[model samples]
Target: MNKRLFLSVFFLCGLILSSNAQEALFGGQNITSPEVHEDGSVTFRLFAPEADVVQVTGDFLPSVKIETQMGPMDGPGKADLTKDDKGVWSFKSEPLPSELYGYSFIIDGFKTTDPNNPFLIRDVASVTNIFIVGNGQADLYRTQDVPHGTVTRRWYDSPGLGMDRRITIYTPPGYETSKDDYPVLYLLHGAGGDEEAWISLGRTAQILDNLIAEKKVKPMIVVMPNGNVIQDAAPGEGNKGYYKPQFMVPKTMDGTYEGAFEDIIKFVESNYQVKANKENRAIAGLSMGGYHSLHISRYYPNTFDYVGLFSAAIMAREDATGKVYSDFDQTLKTQMDNGYKLYWIAIGKTDFLYDANKEYRSKLDSMGMEYNYVESEGGHIWRNWRVYLTQFTPMLFQ
Candidate 1:
C-alpha cells in the first residue's frame, strides 16, 4: 500500500478506538451537568453531540411534552440544547429549586444518565442525583445530624428476570434494641436505576436520621429494591422508540420469587432487629418505584400498613391521560379506605400527574377514603421526593 493509503487506514483505526473510548467514558449516550446560579433556579445541561435530538427529562420537566415545563420548575421552557463547533452537544435550561433532581438524557431516541453528576442515585435504592440548590439539601443532609440508619447491599435469586440481582436496605438506629414489631418501608427504584438509588442519590438515610433525631419523624426501617424486570441492559438500547418497558411488571409481584415480598420483608426482619407488623411495615417509592409501591402494597395488602407514592403512576388513567389513581371499585374501595395507618401520596404541583392527583383525590372524596396527601412546589424530580420523604417519614409510627 502507498504511504498515503497506510496513513488513512491508521487514522480510521484511531477514530474507531477513540469513538469506543468516548462511549466507555460517557456510558455511550448522553452527558449531563448542572449549573447553580445566583437566582433560585438551577440551570441543567445535557450533552449528546452524536445524538440527533437531546431533551432533558426529570421531575422538574413535565410529562406532556419534553420541550416545556410540566411540574414545579415551571419557567425556562424545555428547549433543545445547542451544539458547538466541537461537535459536542450542549443544552441549557433555567435554574431549579434546591433539591435532588432525577434527570435522564435522551439521545438518538435512547435514555442515558449523566456521567458528570456526582449524585448518581439508582432507580431503586438511591435512584436520583443530588444538587444542593439553595433550598433543602444543606439542612437536610449537611447540618442535620440525625441518627444514621444502616445501609446494606444484598443479592436476590430471581427466576423471572433469570438472574441474580442486587438490593440495598436502610435500618434506623435502635432497631437492634427491639425485636418487637416495627414497620418497614420498602423503597423501590425507577427505570435505569438500581438498588443503590435511595441511599446514595436521594440521601435518604441522612435525611431520615436528622428527621428522627429531632422528633420530626418516626424512626423506621427502609428497604430498597431493584424495580426493573431485566437484570441487565437491553440490546440496541442506544436509539430506541416506544416506552414498552412501562408495561412490564416485576415477577416478584406475581409470586415468582417464592416469598419475594417476604424475602425482602424476612431478610429485613431477620437481618435487622426491627418490627414485623402491618403498622410497623410501610412501602413507598418514585416513578417505577412509585408504581411498585402502589402495586406491592395493594397486591400484598397483608404485608404493609403505610404506603408512599411520590410523583407515581398508580392510576390506570394516568397511563392513558396522565391522570392520577382516583376511582376505585367496592372491594378495592373498602381496602383503600380502611387499608393502613397512612395511605399517602405526595407530588409536585407542576408534575404531569397533577391533574391525575386532583382527580384521584376527588375520587377518594367520593369513596370517603381519608388518605394523607401532601403537595409541594416542584416537578417530578428526586428533590421533591427527597424532601417529601423527609416530611413524610415522620408521620409513620406517630
Candidate 2:
C-alpha cells in the first residue's frame, strides 16, 4: 500500500479507538443522573469518583441567605453524597412536597450541574438543574396530555425608550381557529429577571395549559414584557452584550416605564385579537414588577379590573431627590373609587418583603379598599411565585 494511504488509515483507526474509550469511560448513553421514584422520592447519581466529596444543593433543601443586587436571596444548602464501590456518588432524598425545584451538584468545592439531567433553568447569573415532584399542584407545571399553547419571543418598537423591546407572549391553545377575542393578562417579572423569566423559570405555559384544559382558568393571552427601561431586551439579545442587572435604577431614568405602558397595550391590542376593556384586562407581577403593577394600576385606574402583587416591593413612591410623591394618597384613593373587580396581594410568610407587604395592606385598610390576600409558607423564591401565579390566574376573568 502507498505510504500516504497507510498514514491516513492509521489516523482513522486512532480516532475510532479514542471515541470508544471516551464512551466506555463516561458510561455512554445509559447514564441517568436523577431517578424519580413513584412515591415522590428522588435518587441523584453522579459518576465523579475522583472527587473527594460531593453534595447536592437545591430549593428542596434548606437555603442560606446570600446578598444580591435585589436584596438578600435564599440559596440551597448542601446535602452530602455517598460514594459507592464503583466510584459513583449517589444520594436519595426524602419524599418532598409536590413542586418544582432547582438543584445542582457540588464536587470538591466546585458547583456543577448533573451531567445526566438534561433539564435546566437559568436564574439570574446561574444555571441549575430542575426537577418536578408531581401528583398535586406540581402536576400543573408539568406538560400534560392536553392541548398546549404556543410561546413566542416577539419584538416591538418602543419609541419612548428609543429602542426595540422583546417580549414573551403565550397565546392560548385555540387562539388560531377560534373567532373569539380573549382577555389579556400583563404579567411582569421581578428584579434580576426579564421577559423570558416567567415562561422559562416560572413554567407559565405549562400552568396555563393545564388550567385551561381542566376548564379552571379562562382561555386568555398572557404577555410578559421586559420591565427594565434602560435597556430594551434581556442580556445577549439584539447583539447587545450581557448587561449586569441593576436594581432600583430604571425608575430613575428620564422616561418612566409607566408612561410607556401605552405602547405595550397598543401593540398587543393591534397584533392580537383581545378583549381590550377594563373587565377583561388584568395586570400582575412579582417583586419589582409588583411595584410597577401597583403604580400602573393606580395611574391608569380604568385600564385593568384585576391587579395582583406577589411579594411586591411596596413602599412610598419617591422622586429623584428622595421625597415621596405628593399625590400618592389621592391617586390611590382615585384608583379605589374607580371600582376594580379584584385587587389581590400574595406573599410568603418568610419573604424578605413581608413587612413591606404588611404595611401596604395596612394602608389599604385605612383607605377602605377591599382586596384579596393570600399568605403561604416559604420565602422569596420561584416556588412561591409559581404557586402565587397558579392561584392568581384562576381568579381572573371570572
Best by lDDT: 2
Report lDDT (CA) for all predictions.
Answer: 0.63, 0.86
Q: What is the lDDT, from 0 to 100, of the residue 239 in candidate 2? A: 50
Candidate 2, which segments miss by more than 4 Å at Cα? Answer: 1-30, 69-73, 242-255, 316-326
Q: Candidate 2, overall lDDT?
A: 0.86
Query: What is the TM-score (0 to 1) of candidate 2?
Result: 0.91
What TM-score against the true fold does each predicted structure earn?
A: 0.62, 0.91
* Residue-by-residue lDDT tens digits, candidate 1, 1-398: 99999999999999999999988876664644766667755555654456677766665554443442223334322445566765655655466556545566666666666666756544322234545655545467653545566777777555444565567777777766655555667777654455656776678788877777877877677877766545432212212332333324444233232224555665566666666677787788876577667656655656667778888765542233211223235434656755678888898987767787787678778878778888887666666777777767877876
lDDT (Cα, 0-100) at 169 in candidate 2: 98
As for candidate 2, its clashing pairs are: none
Q: State the lDDT of candidate 2 residue by residue for 257-296, as single tens digits.
A: 7768888998999999999899999999998888878878
**TM-score result, candidate 1:** 0.62
Counting only residues 3 or more apart in sequence or on different chains, how many pairs clash (N, Cα, C under 3 Å) in candidate 2? 0
> Deviation in angstroms for 116 in model 2?
1.2
